[model samples]
Target: MINEVILDDFSLKVTSFEQGVSTSSSGTEAKTIRFDFEVRGGTEYHDVTVHLYKNTFDVKVPELDLSFRGTINNYSTSRTDFTNENSSSLFRLELIEIG
Candidate 1:
């Protein structure tokens, strides 16, 4: 289903996001999102943020998470590319692990 998502014009609207966690102590979990979009000229990789919510289902999280936005540029398909907008010195981005 994720492979079906497309990026439009190197720009994508983040629909939904979540931090992947594991119950086992030996495993390491991080934040991720259900990034979806389709763009002409391919989507540009950029530094985006995953806002951590204090209260579940809180709308105010967006504003609070603005500061914690991380730079993670993952392209599910070849249609996406890196651009100036998303090229930040803070974080580096790479391709998603697809199997």
Candidate 2:
């Protein structure tokens, strides 16, 4: 089964964009539009949590696919990397960006 990562209330800001050590004031030169914040939810009860980074892939619309990176529990601390662990559970969380 394929999982989808949803981007709700998504907004990106271009703080700076440089090419070959030169900054471009024009919007065309903007290379990085940071998705500083986002909200994610799961459809399954045991969907766990979703952790995001630049390396992660984006999910399609309508369905929000979530991927979490961390300890399942402090006592158990089982490390897992799954695309579809708990697809039936529904969960939501906020993603905040701090510079």
Root-mean-square deviation per candidate: 11.8, 14.2
Candidate 2 Cα misplacement greater than 4 A, ranges: 1-87
- lDDT at 98, model 1: 16
In order of appearance, the predictions have TM-scores of: 0.28, 0.18
What would the per-residue lDDT of candidate 1 be over residues 22-48, giving only the tens digit for each residue?
Answer: 233555443333444322331323222
Best by lDDT: 1
Q: Cα lDDT for residue 96, model 2?
A: 24
lDDT (10s digit) by residue, model 2, range 1-99: 113324333222212211121134552321111112212233321222333323232322232223222111111112333345342221222222111
Count of clashing residue pairs in every prediction: 15, 8
The local distance difference test score of model 2 is 0.25
lDDT of 1: 0.29
Off by over 4 Å in 1: 1-11, 15-19, 22-25, 42-74, 78-99
